[model samples]
Structure formats: structure tokens, C-alpha cells
Target: MADPTLSRRHLFQASAGLAAALLPARAQAKARLGDDGLYTEDWYVDSFLDLPEDFAAARGKGRGFALQWSQRGCIYCKELHTAYFADPAIETPIREAFDIVHLDLFGAREVTFLDGARLTEKALGQRERIRATPTFQFFAEVDGKPKEVARMPGLLPRPEFSALFRYVAEGAYAREPFDAWLGKQGKG
Candidate 1:
């Protein structure tokens, strides 16, 4: 008296469940190694290297715009993609609130600046005075155009990193210094 169709449905469901169970419990990739030899996050913005357009798109999403400057063979860059971002408490808010564009500190790919200057990534790095890998350039709209507002020269440990991102999100730089704000938040 058992319905064959019902039995088949249960078998299929069980098969699917078993397949899932057979897979690795921690199958998620922490980071991807790009062709450029840099490690990157899955959530980083993909773009045409147009700074103005990228900024506009990020603004449209109601998110902050940031440029992540890194280089090939940079150990700190690897840690940024792996360890720092692995912390949900650190990554969640920042990932949700910012549109991060990754750039190579020493790359040949062309990038168009907000000022309409088209240059290679290496040139842009020089123009921006970038002397270190894993620098973060935070931009804000000023006079109806994207302008760099904050620059973090290198990586910070978890709490400070979290606080820095929060500081940018809160627009706290206009009101006070980062150290002062960090102290106020009890994270300095």
C-alpha cells in the first residue's frame, strides 16, 4: 500500500543529505590567489579601474569607498586576506558597509583616476606616495567628486583595524583624530 513516488522522494532527499554530509565541513576558501600573485577576498569590488565610476557605484550602494593597496609577495597582504578577515566580528560590519577596490602597488594594469588621469597602477602608487603594501586609502565626496580623506599606511591588529573601519563609517575623522576616537571607544 506504500506509494512508490513518496518512497522515491524520500530516497532522493536522503541521497542529497548524505552527499552533503560526505563533503568537508569547512569547505569554504579563506582567500584566493589571483593571477597577479596577490591574495584577495571574495567580497572585494570588481571594476574597470575607473576611480570616479567606482566611487559613484559605491555611493549608489550607500557604502564607503576604499582602495586597498597591496603588492605581490607581501606577507601582510596575505594575512589581511586570511587572518584579519577571518574574524566575523571584524569582517562582517566592514564587508557590509564598504566597497573595497583592490589595487596593486606595483602593477602594470591601467587605472583611471578621479581627475581623469589614466595611468598604470604603479604610477598611481607613486603619485599617491604609496611607500608600503597593504595601505588603505579611504575616499569621501568633496565638491561633488571623490577625494581621499584618510590613508592607513599599514595593517593593524584586529581591534585597531575594526576601530579604523568604524571610524571611517562614523565620519569621525572630521570631528576628531583616530587615536582620540579609538581611546573614546576603549579600543586604543
Candidate 2:
């Protein structure tokens, strides 16, 4: 009794409308950037590696968060931000798992170290030989001194980075090299 042709057309239109409605949400979900805007001055990136003076003095309070020092106008740095940190695949775990401090690698802002010495982020980077932009340092306090346990430069693929994070979070550095541990993770 009904008009089949008109009914099919109407059905197609409804389906198309539903797909259109979901388009924006799907795009947004894929590009879920943090409010930080990828390391612009608007928001500070987190560096969980830095330890407070008192914490450093204790020397063995277990591992804390890592530190990330970055500056504006660096291409590789921006890539690291957008391709790695900003990606929802990585950001959520990092936020939940560590304490992060964002340092302006070029700004005049001052940071006090574990030894009670203070310096600008640029100076600290220089001392640490971070000639490369976006150096990720895994830090720990040993014998009342700040120590860098691992230094990874540039952008890493999500899976590799996630494995490295897992290794560090588990304190595997206490007994083995990160690369060796990473090999083990990849096998499984």
C-alpha cells in the first residue's frame, strides 16, 4: 500500500543525517588535544622527574615523575608535543601515572634544584647538554644528588614510548638496561 521508492529515499536521507551528526564528534575524538595547546605559553607542560630539595635529601623515596623542558619555535619540539604528548593515546596515561612539571626552556623563569640551587630552564638545559630540542629525561635522586637515569631524544612511536614508560614506571632500571627490558616487552 505504501510508496516503496519514497520510503527508501527518506530512509537514506535519515541515515545520511545521522552520519553527518556524528562526523564532528568522531573528528574531535581523533584529535582530542589537551587544553595546553601543545606546549605554548598558555599552559605549562608537566615534568614529573624533578624532585624537591627535601625529597632529594632523602635519596631513596622511590621514583617520582619525570621532567620535560621545552621552548617555543622549535619544530621538533612542536612535533613531540602534537604527535606524542597531545595524542590522547599517550597523554591520559602520562597524566595518571606521573608528576609533571613544565619548564619554559627559553624563558627567564627560575627553578630550584634538588640541591637547593636555582637556575633558569635554559641554563639547566645547557648544563644537561640538551642541544636537541624535546629531550625526555628520566630522573632520580641518589645520595642527595639529582641523577639522570635515562635520556631519550626526539619523537618515539606510541608503542615504543608506552613500553619505555612502563619499564621506567616499574623501576626496571634498578636491575637492567631500558633497551634490554624493551626487547623483552616487544617479544611478549
Candidate 3:
């Protein structure tokens, strides 16, 4: 006759091993940092930090401009890049619809705002009153000025995030609030 205690211990050990095996992929999926100590991605648009030019280029391609603000040591930013943005469902639509530009929240790199104001990334963040990492500012050209159509101040779940890209891509921001549009889609 087998000891019940021993059998239970074995079962527990197996379950623990299985859980441990599943943890690595997610735990190890930390975003890769560049030499500048910023997370790097090939998909991010390499720009001269000229917002007007970037907006025009994106419009020329029939897309909108997406500015993604991140900072070093921001876990939310890391999670967004590693988990949410990495999702195929989210990446596909964003790649197709927006010219995504990455901005370091505290970076010293010079940027020319759409209104022709020159400032460093840090100054721009200050001017924009960005209080969170991973803030997304979406823009559309209106009357020759790049107007902010929508702004997301923090990380959104995959469904909402994907919907955001579609919302901007479809020019729905001009007609309705994101929450209203999301509600119509039964996501609210």
C-alpha cells in the first residue's frame, strides 16, 4: 500500500515544476535596452524629432502620427513594449495605421514641435504635462496644423489598445470620444 502523504507530496512537486516551467517565458520577456539605456525596436520610426515633418510624412502615407513617450526604468513601459505591443493582434493594426515615434521622457534630444517650437524631449514632456510613462499622443493634420486628436496617458489592455489604433486610423476621433466609440463596439 502506498503512503497517501507521499503521493500528495509527489503531486504537489509536479504541479510546482509545471508552474515554474511556465514562468520563464513571461519573466524573461523583459524589453531589451539599447546603449542609450532606452528600449529599442526596429518598428519605431527613426525621425529627426521634427513633429511637423513627421506628421506630414505620415499623412502622405495616409496614416496618423503616434508619439509614444517612455522613460528609463519604467516598468509599465517595459510591460507595454514586451507584452502588449508584442501581441500580434495589436502590432498588425498599429503598424499598418500609424507612424509610431518613440520619445524618451527625460531625453536631451532636440525636438521641433508641430507649432515650430524647439525643445528637448524632456522639455516637451514638461510642456505636455505628461505625468505617466507610456503616454500616447495621437495627432491628425487639421487646417495645416497638427492637432491632437486623442491622448492616452497610460497603458491600456490589448483590446482597448488595438481599438485605439483603429479609432485613430479611421478618423473616429473627429466624431466621437474614444469611450463612446468603444462602448459602441461593446467593449465599454
Candidate 4:
């Protein structure tokens, strides 16, 4: 007869070995932290926090302005960077279609609105009624001013996020609401 103790020991050892083998992969799935303890990416556009100028610049580059509002210690932001933005399929379209700028939800950095209003990043978020981290504000030029065309208030799944890039890039927001457009594309 087989020894029950030996069988249990073998099972435990195998489970431990499998977990050890998966450690690197689990680590790799985590987002890399910046000096400020927030996730960072090299391709995000560096700007002077001027919305009008940034919008014009993005248009000049054939892209829209994407303001990403985040806060430190936001797990959703980390997931957005690590899981969604890290995917080449999603990142490539976003990089091609939008000039992304990061804004801290509670930071004191100065920001100039398109209407010539100046406020701190935190104040701006308050003025905009942004109550959540990882909010994405997409803008397009409307009559020489940067107008907010769409807003994603929270983290979207990978497919929806990718579809968002496509919808904006294709100028579908001008014709219909994002939900309608998304539904038309069978991605809603």
C-alpha cells in the first residue's frame, strides 16, 4: 500500500514548485512605478498644461488631446497602465490617435483651460466635477476652442477601450453618442 503522508508531501511540493514558476509572470503583470509612486509611460505627451495650445498641437499632429486624470495609490490606474495600455493592440491605436497627457487629480500644478481660465490641477478636477480617479477626458477643437467631446469616468475593459480609440479617431463622436457608436460597432 502507498504511504498517505508521502502522497500529501508530493502534492504540496508540486504546488509550491508551480507557484514559484509563476512568480516572474505575476511580477511582470504589475505596473512599473514612477518616482511619484504612479505608473508612467514614455510615449505620453509632455505639455505645458495649457489645454488650448495642447489641443492645437495635437491637431497639428493629426491627433486628439486626451487628458488622463489619475491619483497616487489608484489601483485602477495601475491596472490601466499595466493591463490595458501595456497591450500593443490598444497602445498602438491610442498612441496614433491621441496625444495623452497625465494630470494628477489632487496635485497643485497649474493648468490653463481653453477659455483662458487658470487653476490648479486639483481645483480643475473639482471644477470639472471629477469625482473619480482614472478619468479620461477627450477633446476636440470646436470653433477655435478645445471642447470636451467625450469622457470616460472609469476604467474600461480592453475591448471597449480599444473601441474608444477607434471611435474617436474615426470622428464618430461628431455624429452620435459614444454608446450608440459603440453599439453600432457591436462593441457596447
Query: Which numbered prediction scores highest in TM-score against the true structure?
Result: 1
CA RMSD per model (angstroms): 3.9, 9.0, 10.8, 11.1
Model 3 C-alpha lDDT per residue in residues 25-44, reported as the tens digit of each score = 54344456777767755667
- Model 1 residue pairs with clashes: none
Best by lDDT: 1
Using lDDT as the yardstick, the better of models 3 and 4 is 3
Where does candidate 2 have its weakest 10-residue lDDT segment? 40-49
lDDT of 2 by residue, 1-188 (tens): 87566677798999999999996653344322344333532223333324474344333434355666666666766766656655656766665555546555564657776655677777877766776656677766555556767766755667877766777677787779988888787475
The reply for model 4, stretches above 4 Å from the true place, is 1-32, 186-188
Ranking by TM-score: 1, 3, 4, 2
lDDT for each candidate structure: 0.87, 0.61, 0.84, 0.82
**lDDT tens per residue, model 4, 40-110:** 66778778998778878889988878889999999999989888866766776787778988889898889
lDDT tens readout by residue for model 1, 50-161: 9899999999988999999999999999898888887676777998999999999989999998889999999999999998879999998877878887888889877898
lDDT against true structure, model 3 = 0.84
> How many clashes in each structure?
0, 11, 0, 0
TM-score of each: 0.84, 0.65, 0.80, 0.80
lDDT of 2: 0.61
